[model samples]
Target: MRIETALAAVAVFSLGLSSADAETPFKLGTFERNGRTFPGLVLEDRWVVDIAAANARLQKQHPSWKALAIPAGMKELIERYDGGLRERLHAIANEPGAATPRVDTYEVKALRVRPPVPDPETMVNAAVNYVEHGAEVAGGTQAPTPSPTMAPSVPGLWERPANDIRWTPYLFLKARSALIGAGEAIRIPPGRDKIDWECELAVIVGRRASRVSVGQAREHIFGYTLEDDVSDRGGRGDARHGSDWLVGKSHDTFAPVGPFIVPKEFVPDPQALAIRFALSGKVMQDSSTARMTHTVDELLQYASNILTLRPGDVISTGSPAGVGFTRNPPVFMKPGDVAACTIERIGTLTNPVAAGP
Candidate 1:
């Protein structure tokens, strides 16, 4: 009798716990505007939509489409989530006396749906971290760039922008300003020559870390996202004093990150993903993460040694073989072309290239 009673109590407790867990309100719903359906945040109907929906409506309303200016509040939301911000936004939506910007009146629809955490900082990209890219760029065999002294200080030391000779694990900073949500248009800067696309797996930092060990490095990661390190490959591959990677790589819409942030809990083994890229709907770059010369853990351990990586910092663990510049005939992006970058678990990030400033 006693044993039976204990088992019953255990079952009851488990049931109660599951019931309680279900109460955690997570925003989930489809965002629909002007008769079109797209994934969107689920805020209380009162939340503002001007920034998210305004431009979409305008683009639909007008023929001359302009990129929607990122809203001011978007930054605040990203900052909050960067600090482990997760909660039911509904209470803020439902409370009679909650913050203003009510549901129905807001410009964007606030249907309930989970949104990604804003990255705390921009992506710290390890350039030519792959052996193949290094070899191709050198126009010779894959001779490794002498690994910089494995210390904690080397990551921040490489602060140059894109499109330069990356003899080492040349690190560069992609402006947080350069980030674009998935499915958005990637504006091709005007008067640009040699626009090339690189498919890379970007690691998202999960926790505060400094000098983390390689074994513990994966724990500091939240998950991963996809980014196209679109660069002006023309001047960059020159093997000269300064290839203009910075201006080429940092163009307004050069970096397209998203589809969604695959929370780390879902991806147990990130190093083994398959990454592929398609241009104008044709497969151009195809390879696996296994080809990476520097593993994700090595990259993280090396980066943390240099700077304090706060939650939401991203490291784009280099691209695989088959970048456009590496092609026999050299395939470059042109206007009216859609480039698709796919990595296992992270989903596909597709953007239509448009001519713009």
Candidate 2:
């Protein structure tokens, strides 16, 4: 579909409404059935419509129209998203019995719900981006005292805002191979105890971005999804090199992302959502994105200045306080435990913990 047509369709479907509106319909994700993966539209009662198949049918019906050719995969859709594809999707969703056998649809419970972007180029994560989380992880202590009688600080000598006690959005890279979808197992590697859960709001990059300013960062975001930044607290580096995030954070199935990816247009404010997670039906981390010290735009701007962010790159915008490692006596996820992370507007991403080989 033409980009303008697609955009107009989304406008008609959403009526320029925010996701918080009760009338907003449909969320997006990827699903697997019989070993075949396709983009899907999440429906009521754990059912989903295979959009790729639906688009194929639409194309066959309208051979003369060139605009019916929608992107086949999530990454392509995001990378090329203009208004046309979204509008086409809205039309497909509005079709009567679209989720019925006429279109390829399946009960989500009977199939696998994979990560929205199954293969991102890079997954960048923000560390301690929330004030309370930074304090909690630092044992709620104050910064060390500066030497008494020190000379008055010069501009270069004085710490910049980015380098001061106020935590900047410290970014780290996670292995894309570690990603798993909702309902998948987060296998706890043997001998690595203290596996903790961090429910974070993850942003999916829609376009190529490099050195974008904070004001322009929002323009490059395609959508928002939930991510559980699973960590092995015991694997952190000791007194020498400090915490080894790669070893602690990058394990197979360490990043359990998505139940769905809500389009950025649907989510009006990325920093105002309520985020929470539970372990085995017991609520653990419960907070709002409002508590974040550095907003999603700031984090994106910071990271883009350092390196290029291509389409399908994921930026995990940090978790709130209440992580297990910061708790008294430390609590961790054990095998057989279920971890569920939820964000308002965005859905819940639940994964079961299993013993690794």
Q: For candidate 2, what is the lDDT?
A: 0.79
Model 1 clash number: 16
Candidate 1 lDDT: 0.60
Report the Cα RMSD per candidate: 11.8, 4.8
* Candidate 2 lDDT for residue 220: 90
Each model's lDDT comes to 0.60, 0.79
What is candidate 1's lDDT per residue for 223-248, written digit by digit as tens? 67787887876564566776665776
The candidate scoring highest on lDDT is 2
Off by over 4 Å in 1: 1-119, 141-168, 236-241
Return the lDDT, model 1, position 161. 32
**What TM-score quantifies how close candidate 2 is to the native fold?**
0.86
Q: After superposition, which runs of candidate 2 have C-alpha atoms over 4 Å from their true positions?
A: 1-6, 9-23, 59-66, 99-102, 141-165, 236-238
